[model samples]
Target: MSVTLKLATSLDGRIATAAGQSKWITGERSRAAVHQLRAEHDAVLVGAETALADDPELTVRLPGYAGRQPARVVLDSRQRLPTTAKLVQTAREIPTYLVATEAPQARLTDAGVRVLQAPALGEDRPELKAVLEALAREGLRRLFVEGGGQVAASFLRCGLVDAVEWFRAPIVIGGEGRPAIGALAVAGLADAPHFRRTEVRELGDDLWERYERI
Candidate 1:
Protein backbone atom coordinates (compact mmCIF):
# COMPACT_ATOMS: atom_id res chain seq x y z
CA MET A 1 0.00 0.00 0.00
CA SER A 2 1.14 3.51 -0.82
CA VAL A 3 0.59 6.44 1.52
CA THR A 4 0.15 10.00 0.31
CA LEU A 5 0.90 12.83 2.71
CA LYS A 6 -1.30 15.85 2.07
CA LEU A 7 -1.00 19.25 3.74
CA ALA A 8 -2.08 22.87 3.40
CA THR A 9 0.40 25.38 4.74
CA SER A 10 1.05 29.10 4.61
CA LEU A 11 3.77 30.58 2.41
CA ASP A 12 5.77 31.04 5.57
CA GLY A 13 5.50 27.32 6.34
CA ARG A 14 2.91 27.51 9.10
CA ILE A 15 -0.19 25.31 9.22
CA ALA A 16 -1.97 26.95 12.12
CA THR A 17 -1.92 30.09 14.22
CA ALA A 18 -0.11 30.46 17.50
CA ALA A 19 -3.23 29.46 19.38
CA GLY A 20 -3.99 26.50 17.05
CA GLN A 21 -6.53 28.49 15.04
CA SER A 22 -6.37 26.93 11.55
CA LYS A 23 -9.69 27.81 9.99
CA TRP A 24 -9.62 28.84 6.31
CA ILE A 25 -5.87 28.81 5.81
CA THR A 26 -6.21 27.85 2.17
CA GLY A 27 -8.50 29.26 -0.53
CA GLU A 28 -11.78 27.66 -1.60
CA ARG A 29 -10.29 26.02 -4.68
CA SER A 30 -7.60 24.36 -2.62
CA ARG A 31 -10.12 23.16 -0.06
CA ALA A 32 -12.32 21.79 -2.88
CA ALA A 33 -9.33 19.99 -4.32
CA VAL A 34 -8.76 18.37 -0.93
CA HIS A 35 -12.28 17.00 -0.98
CA GLN A 36 -11.66 15.51 -4.40
CA LEU A 37 -8.48 13.87 -3.11
CA ARG A 38 -10.42 12.49 -0.18
CA ALA A 39 -12.88 10.96 -2.62
CA GLU A 40 -10.02 9.14 -4.32
CA HIS A 41 -8.36 7.67 -1.23
CA ASP A 42 -9.46 4.53 0.66
CA ALA A 43 -8.78 5.91 4.12
CA VAL A 44 -7.90 9.24 5.76
CA LEU A 45 -5.47 9.22 8.70
CA VAL A 46 -5.00 11.96 11.24
CA GLY A 47 -3.28 12.33 14.59
CA ALA A 48 -5.03 12.60 17.92
CA GLU A 49 -3.91 16.21 18.26
CA THR A 50 -5.70 17.17 15.06
CA ALA A 51 -8.80 15.31 16.18
CA LEU A 52 -8.89 17.23 19.43
CA ALA A 53 -8.01 20.58 17.87
CA ASP A 54 -9.94 20.62 14.60
CA ASP A 55 -12.78 18.18 15.34
CA PRO A 56 -13.01 17.48 11.61
CA GLU A 57 -15.66 15.09 10.36
CA LEU A 58 -13.19 13.93 7.63
CA THR A 59 -15.92 13.47 5.05
CA VAL A 60 -16.02 14.51 1.39
CA ARG A 61 -18.24 17.56 1.40
CA LEU A 62 -17.76 18.96 -2.08
CA PRO A 63 -20.82 19.66 -4.21
CA GLY A 64 -22.21 16.53 -5.91
CA TYR A 65 -20.21 14.39 -3.47
CA ALA A 66 -23.07 13.62 -1.13
CA GLY A 67 -22.69 9.88 -0.73
CA ARG A 68 -18.92 9.56 -1.13
CA GLN A 69 -17.05 9.23 2.16
CA PRO A 70 -13.81 7.51 3.11
CA ALA A 71 -13.06 5.64 6.31
CA ARG A 72 -11.87 8.07 8.96
CA VAL A 73 -8.85 6.86 10.93
CA VAL A 74 -7.33 8.28 14.08
CA LEU A 75 -3.79 7.54 15.32
CA ASP A 76 -4.29 7.70 19.03
CA SER A 77 -1.29 5.97 20.54
CA ARG A 78 -2.31 6.37 24.15
CA GLN A 79 -6.01 5.97 23.42
CA ARG A 80 -6.52 9.63 24.08
CA LEU A 81 -9.36 9.93 21.60
CA PRO A 82 -12.35 11.75 22.98
CA THR A 83 -15.68 9.95 22.95
CA THR A 84 -17.47 13.21 22.22
CA ALA A 85 -15.37 13.94 19.16
CA LYS A 86 -17.18 14.85 15.96
CA LEU A 87 -15.29 12.10 14.13
CA VAL A 88 -17.14 9.61 16.31
CA GLN A 89 -20.56 11.23 16.26
CA THR A 90 -20.73 12.35 12.59
CA ALA A 91 -19.27 9.17 11.11
CA ARG A 92 -22.54 7.28 10.77
CA GLU A 93 -22.04 5.89 7.27
CA ILE A 94 -18.27 5.83 7.06
CA PRO A 95 -16.44 3.61 9.53
CA THR A 96 -14.05 5.16 12.07
CA TYR A 97 -11.11 3.25 13.48
CA LEU A 98 -8.99 4.18 16.47
CA VAL A 99 -5.43 2.84 16.39
CA ALA A 100 -3.93 2.90 19.84
CA THR A 101 -1.97 0.91 22.41
CA GLU A 102 -3.49 -2.12 24.15
CA ALA A 103 -4.15 -0.11 27.29
CA PRO A 104 -6.86 2.00 25.63
CA GLN A 105 -8.19 -0.63 23.27
CA ALA A 106 -11.13 -1.78 25.36
CA ARG A 107 -12.35 1.68 26.20
CA LEU A 108 -12.26 2.74 22.57
CA THR A 109 -14.03 -0.43 21.53
CA ASP A 110 -16.71 0.23 24.12
CA ALA A 111 -17.19 3.68 22.61
CA GLY A 112 -18.43 2.05 19.36
CA VAL A 113 -15.28 2.60 17.26
CA ARG A 114 -13.22 -0.33 16.12
CA VAL A 115 -9.96 -0.41 18.07
CA LEU A 116 -6.69 -1.97 16.98
CA GLN A 117 -3.54 -2.28 19.09
CA ALA A 118 -0.29 -2.11 17.13
CA PRO A 119 3.35 -2.13 18.23
CA ALA A 120 4.30 1.16 19.82
CA LEU A 121 7.44 3.13 19.00
CA GLY A 122 7.72 4.31 22.57
CA GLU A 123 5.62 3.96 25.66
CA ASP A 124 2.48 5.34 24.00
CA ARG A 125 3.42 6.14 20.41
CA PRO A 126 2.47 3.80 17.60
CA GLU A 127 5.21 2.66 15.25
CA LEU A 128 4.55 4.09 11.80
CA LYS A 129 5.75 1.08 9.83
CA ALA A 130 3.82 -1.35 12.00
CA VAL A 131 0.63 0.66 11.71
CA LEU A 132 0.99 0.86 7.92
CA GLU A 133 1.57 -2.85 7.64
CA ALA A 134 -1.49 -3.53 9.76
CA LEU A 135 -3.59 -1.25 7.61
CA ALA A 136 -2.24 -2.92 4.47
CA ARG A 137 -3.22 -6.31 5.82
CA GLU A 138 -6.73 -4.96 6.23
CA GLY A 139 -6.77 -4.14 2.47
CA LEU A 140 -6.27 -0.39 2.61
CA ARG A 141 -4.62 0.28 -0.75
CA ARG A 142 -4.27 4.03 -0.70
CA LEU A 143 -3.78 5.90 2.58
CA PHE A 144 -4.14 9.67 2.80
CA VAL A 145 -2.41 11.32 5.74
CA GLU A 146 -3.74 14.71 6.74
CA GLY A 147 -2.06 16.02 9.81
CA GLY A 148 -1.12 18.83 12.19
CA GLY A 149 2.67 18.28 11.63
CA GLN A 150 4.11 15.61 13.96
CA VAL A 151 2.25 12.79 12.23
CA ALA A 152 3.48 13.90 8.83
CA ALA A 153 7.06 14.05 10.07
CA SER A 154 6.84 10.56 11.50
CA PHE A 155 5.68 9.07 8.19
CA LEU A 156 8.40 10.88 6.30
CA ARG A 157 11.03 9.80 8.78
CA CYS A 158 9.88 6.20 8.49
CA GLY A 159 10.10 6.39 4.65
CA LEU A 160 6.43 5.43 4.38
CA VAL A 161 5.38 8.54 2.45
CA ASP A 162 5.20 7.83 -1.27
CA ALA A 163 3.73 11.13 -2.39
CA VAL A 164 3.20 14.66 -1.15
CA GLU A 165 0.50 17.18 -2.09
CA TRP A 166 1.14 20.56 -0.58
CA PHE A 167 -1.05 23.65 -0.95
CA ARG A 168 0.76 26.85 -0.06
CA ALA A 169 -1.49 29.71 0.85
CA PRO A 170 -0.30 33.30 0.28
CA ILE A 171 -0.68 34.28 3.89
CA VAL A 172 1.94 34.20 6.65
CA ILE A 173 1.37 33.09 10.21
CA GLY A 174 4.43 34.08 12.15
CA GLY A 175 5.47 33.32 15.73
CA GLU A 176 4.57 29.98 17.44
CA GLY A 177 2.45 28.11 14.86
CA ARG A 178 3.00 24.56 13.63
CA PRO A 179 5.31 24.12 10.63
CA ALA A 180 4.44 22.67 7.22
CA ILE A 181 6.47 19.56 8.10
CA GLY A 182 7.20 19.11 11.78
CA ALA A 183 10.72 18.95 13.18
CA LEU A 184 12.64 15.75 12.50
CA ALA A 185 16.21 14.64 13.09
CA VAL A 186 17.07 14.56 9.42
CA ALA A 187 20.82 14.91 8.98
CA GLY A 188 21.12 16.80 5.70
CA LEU A 189 19.53 17.44 2.32
CA ALA A 190 21.33 14.38 0.93
CA ASP A 191 19.63 12.26 3.58
CA ALA A 192 16.20 13.40 2.39
CA PRO A 193 14.34 11.10 0.05
CA HIS A 194 14.34 12.15 -3.62
CA PHE A 195 11.04 13.57 -4.86
CA ARG A 196 10.10 14.61 -8.37
CA ARG A 197 7.63 17.42 -8.80
CA THR A 198 4.76 15.89 -10.74
CA GLU A 199 2.25 18.74 -10.83
CA VAL A 200 1.88 22.38 -9.93
CA ARG A 201 -1.21 24.57 -10.18
CA GLU A 202 -2.61 27.78 -8.94
CA LEU A 203 -5.70 27.33 -6.83
CA GLY A 204 -6.91 30.88 -6.53
CA ASP A 205 -4.21 32.52 -4.40
CA ASP A 206 -2.74 29.21 -3.19
CA LEU A 207 -0.08 27.27 -5.07
CA TRP A 208 -0.58 23.52 -5.09
CA GLU A 209 2.55 21.44 -5.54
CA ARG A 210 2.36 17.69 -6.07
CA TYR A 211 5.47 15.55 -5.73
CA GLU A 212 6.06 11.84 -6.21
CA ARG A 213 8.88 9.78 -4.78
CA ILE A 214 11.62 9.25 -7.33
Candidate 2:
Protein backbone atom coordinates (compact mmCIF):
# COMPACT_ATOMS: atom_id res chain seq x y z
CA MET A 1 0.00 0.00 0.00
CA SER A 2 1.23 3.48 -0.84
CA VAL A 3 0.44 6.35 1.54
CA THR A 4 0.54 9.90 0.18
CA LEU A 5 0.57 12.90 2.47
CA LYS A 6 -1.00 16.06 1.02
CA LEU A 7 -1.21 19.54 2.53
CA ALA A 8 -1.71 23.22 1.61
CA THR A 9 0.15 25.84 3.59
CA SER A 10 1.09 29.51 3.44
CA LEU A 11 4.38 30.72 2.02
CA ASP A 12 5.56 30.90 5.62
CA GLY A 13 4.55 27.26 6.20
CA ARG A 14 1.41 28.02 8.22
CA ILE A 15 -1.69 25.90 7.70
CA ALA A 16 -4.20 28.14 9.48
CA THR A 17 -4.49 31.78 10.35
CA ALA A 18 -3.79 33.28 13.74
CA ALA A 19 -7.50 33.14 14.52
CA GLY A 20 -7.81 29.72 12.85
CA GLN A 21 -9.31 31.20 9.69
CA SER A 22 -8.36 28.82 6.85
CA LYS A 23 -10.96 29.20 4.16
CA TRP A 24 -9.77 29.84 0.58
CA ILE A 25 -6.12 29.63 1.48
CA THR A 26 -5.39 27.94 -1.82
CA GLY A 27 -6.80 28.96 -5.21
CA GLU A 28 -9.34 27.08 -7.30
CA ARG A 29 -6.68 25.20 -9.26
CA SER A 30 -5.16 23.79 -6.11
CA ARG A 31 -8.57 22.78 -4.84
CA ALA A 32 -9.33 21.10 -8.15
CA ALA A 33 -6.11 19.15 -7.91
CA VAL A 34 -7.07 18.04 -4.44
CA HIS A 35 -10.44 16.78 -5.65
CA GLN A 36 -8.75 14.82 -8.44
CA LEU A 37 -6.41 13.22 -5.89
CA ARG A 38 -9.37 12.38 -3.66
CA ALA A 39 -11.11 10.73 -6.56
CA GLU A 40 -8.04 8.65 -7.34
CA HIS A 41 -7.32 7.49 -3.80
CA ASP A 42 -9.12 4.60 -2.11
CA ALA A 43 -9.74 6.54 1.10
CA VAL A 44 -9.18 10.00 2.50
CA LEU A 45 -7.86 10.18 6.08
CA VAL A 46 -7.67 13.01 8.59
CA GLY A 47 -7.18 13.49 12.30
CA ALA A 48 -9.90 14.34 14.81
CA GLU A 49 -8.70 17.92 15.20
CA THR A 50 -9.14 18.56 11.46
CA ALA A 51 -12.57 16.95 11.51
CA LEU A 52 -13.70 19.20 14.39
CA ALA A 53 -12.07 22.31 13.02
CA ASP A 54 -12.95 22.06 9.34
CA ASP A 55 -16.16 20.02 9.30
CA PRO A 56 -15.42 19.33 5.65
CA GLU A 57 -17.71 17.15 3.59
CA LEU A 58 -14.62 15.19 2.42
CA THR A 59 -16.15 14.39 -0.96
CA VAL A 60 -14.91 14.80 -4.51
CA ARG A 61 -17.08 17.62 -5.84
CA LEU A 62 -15.55 18.67 -9.15
CA PRO A 63 -17.74 19.36 -12.16
CA GLY A 64 -18.72 16.27 -14.19
CA TYR A 65 -17.31 14.16 -11.33
CA ALA A 66 -20.45 13.17 -9.55
CA GLY A 67 -20.96 9.72 -7.99
CA ARG A 68 -17.24 9.34 -7.32
CA GLN A 69 -16.66 9.73 -3.61
CA PRO A 70 -13.87 8.15 -1.62
CA ALA A 71 -14.37 6.53 1.74
CA ARG A 72 -13.76 8.94 4.59
CA VAL A 73 -11.46 7.77 7.40
CA VAL A 74 -11.20 9.62 10.69
CA LEU A 75 -8.45 9.11 13.26
CA ASP A 76 -10.22 9.83 16.50
CA SER A 77 -8.11 8.04 19.05
CA ARG A 78 -10.42 8.92 21.89
CA GLN A 79 -13.58 8.42 19.83
CA ARG A 80 -14.37 12.10 20.08
CA LEU A 81 -16.05 12.29 16.67
CA PRO A 82 -19.38 14.08 16.78
CA THR A 83 -22.47 12.13 15.83
CA THR A 84 -23.71 15.03 13.74
CA ALA A 85 -20.49 15.21 11.73
CA LYS A 86 -20.92 15.23 7.97
CA LEU A 87 -18.86 12.04 7.73
CA VAL A 88 -21.25 10.16 10.00
CA GLN A 89 -24.39 11.60 8.43
CA THR A 90 -23.30 10.52 4.96
CA ALA A 91 -21.66 7.26 5.99
CA ARG A 92 -24.46 5.16 4.53
CA GLU A 93 -23.71 6.55 1.09
CA ILE A 94 -19.94 7.10 1.13
CA PRO A 95 -18.80 4.83 3.97
CA THR A 96 -16.99 6.53 6.83
CA TYR A 97 -14.77 4.67 9.25
CA LEU A 98 -13.94 5.81 12.75
CA VAL A 99 -10.58 4.41 13.81
CA ALA A 100 -10.74 4.47 17.56
CA THR A 101 -10.16 2.45 20.72
CA GLU A 102 -11.93 -0.79 21.60
CA ALA A 103 -14.47 0.78 23.96
CA PRO A 104 -15.84 3.19 21.36
CA GLN A 105 -16.35 0.56 18.68
CA ALA A 106 -19.79 -0.43 19.95
CA ARG A 107 -20.99 3.15 20.21
CA LEU A 108 -19.68 4.02 16.76
CA THR A 109 -21.19 0.84 15.30
CA ASP A 110 -24.49 1.72 16.97
CA ALA A 111 -24.30 5.09 15.27
CA GLY A 112 -24.31 3.30 11.88
CA VAL A 113 -20.69 4.00 10.93
CA ARG A 114 -18.10 1.24 10.59
CA VAL A 115 -15.65 1.20 13.47
CA LEU A 116 -12.18 -0.33 13.67
CA GLN A 117 -10.74 -0.77 17.13
CA ALA A 118 -6.96 -0.71 16.96
CA PRO A 119 -4.27 -0.70 19.65
CA ALA A 120 -4.20 2.45 21.75
CA LEU A 121 -1.16 4.70 21.70
CA GLY A 122 -1.65 5.92 25.25
CA GLU A 123 -4.86 5.53 27.22
CA ASP A 124 -7.04 6.46 24.24
CA ARG A 125 -4.84 7.28 21.25
CA PRO A 126 -4.82 4.76 18.42
CA GLU A 127 -1.47 3.43 17.17
CA LEU A 128 -0.73 5.08 13.81
CA LYS A 129 1.19 2.16 12.28
CA ALA A 130 -1.47 -0.33 13.27
CA VAL A 131 -4.21 1.80 11.80
CA LEU A 132 -2.32 2.18 8.49
CA GLU A 133 -1.63 -1.55 8.27
CA ALA A 134 -5.27 -2.33 8.89
CA LEU A 135 -6.29 0.05 6.16
CA ALA A 136 -3.78 -1.59 3.82
CA ARG A 137 -5.24 -5.00 4.58
CA GLU A 138 -8.68 -3.67 3.71
CA GLY A 139 -7.49 -3.10 0.11
CA LEU A 140 -6.66 0.54 0.51
CA ARG A 141 -3.87 0.60 -2.06
CA ARG A 142 -3.48 4.37 -2.29
CA LEU A 143 -4.05 6.18 0.99
CA PHE A 144 -4.40 9.97 0.84
CA VAL A 145 -3.69 11.64 4.16
CA GLU A 146 -5.03 15.19 4.46
CA GLY A 147 -4.30 16.72 7.78
CA GLY A 148 -3.92 19.59 10.29
CA GLY A 149 -0.21 19.00 10.94
CA GLN A 150 0.01 16.29 13.63
CA VAL A 151 -1.27 13.49 11.42
CA ALA A 152 1.12 14.42 8.60
CA ALA A 153 4.00 14.48 11.05
CA SER A 154 3.05 11.06 12.38
CA PHE A 155 3.22 9.48 8.91
CA LEU A 156 6.48 11.24 8.07
CA ARG A 157 8.08 10.36 11.39
CA CYS A 158 7.12 6.72 11.04
CA GLY A 159 8.67 6.66 7.50
CA LEU A 160 5.34 5.53 6.13
CA VAL A 161 4.79 8.40 3.69
CA ASP A 162 5.53 7.34 0.12
CA ALA A 163 4.84 10.70 -1.49
CA VAL A 164 4.00 14.26 -0.54
CA GLU A 165 2.16 17.01 -2.39
CA TRP A 166 2.61 20.31 -0.61
CA PHE A 167 1.05 23.55 -1.86
CA ARG A 168 2.49 26.89 -0.86
CA ALA A 169 0.09 29.80 -0.91
CA PRO A 170 1.06 33.42 -1.56
CA ILE A 171 -0.34 34.85 1.66
CA VAL A 172 1.48 35.09 4.95
CA ILE A 173 -0.26 34.18 8.17
CA GLY A 174 1.79 35.22 11.16
CA GLY A 175 2.22 33.51 14.51
CA GLU A 176 -0.58 31.78 16.44
CA GLY A 177 -1.19 29.46 13.46
CA ARG A 178 -0.44 25.77 13.20
CA PRO A 179 2.61 24.84 11.13
CA ALA A 180 2.62 22.71 7.98
CA ILE A 181 4.43 19.89 9.83
CA GLY A 182 4.10 19.39 13.56
CA ALA A 183 6.94 18.44 15.90
CA LEU A 184 8.42 14.93 15.76
CA ALA A 185 10.37 13.10 18.43
CA VAL A 186 13.62 12.97 16.51
CA ALA A 187 17.08 12.47 17.94
CA GLY A 188 18.99 14.18 15.10
CA LEU A 189 19.17 14.84 11.35
CA ALA A 190 20.10 11.20 10.71
CA ASP A 191 16.51 10.23 11.40
CA ALA A 192 15.10 12.51 8.71
CA PRO A 193 13.43 10.97 5.68
CA HIS A 194 14.85 11.86 2.29
CA PHE A 195 12.51 13.10 -0.41
CA ARG A 196 13.22 13.50 -4.12
CA ARG A 197 11.39 16.42 -5.65
CA THR A 198 9.42 15.23 -8.63
CA GLU A 199 7.46 18.23 -9.83
CA VAL A 200 6.85 21.90 -9.09
CA ARG A 201 3.99 23.69 -10.73
CA GLU A 202 2.37 27.05 -10.20
CA LEU A 203 -1.41 27.21 -9.88
CA GLY A 204 -2.32 30.88 -10.00
CA ASP A 205 -0.65 32.34 -6.93
CA ASP A 206 -0.06 29.01 -5.22
CA LEU A 207 2.95 26.78 -5.85
CA TRP A 208 2.59 23.02 -5.71
CA GLU A 209 5.55 20.77 -5.01
CA ARG A 210 5.39 17.00 -5.42
CA TYR A 211 8.03 14.76 -3.89
CA GLU A 212 8.62 11.05 -3.67
CA ARG A 213 10.06 9.51 -0.53
CA ILE A 214 13.64 8.33 -1.08
lDDT (C-alpha, whole model) for all candidates: 0.85, 0.86
- CA lDDT, candidate 2, residue 114: 81
TM-score of 1: 0.94
lDDT of 1: 0.85
Model 1 residue 32 CA deviation in Å: 0.4
- The most accurate candidate by lDDT is 2
Please, what are the lDDT tens digits per residue for candidate 1 over residues 1-214?
A: 8899998999888999887778889989999999999999989999999998888898898877666578888998777777788877754556788888675555456666877678878557888877877787777889999996989988888888899999999998985887868867879999887789999999999999999998
Model 2, 19-38: lDDT tens digits are: 78888789999999999999
> How high is the lDDT of residue 134 in model 2?
80
- Report each candidate's C-alpha RMSD, comma-separated, in the order given: 1.5, 1.5
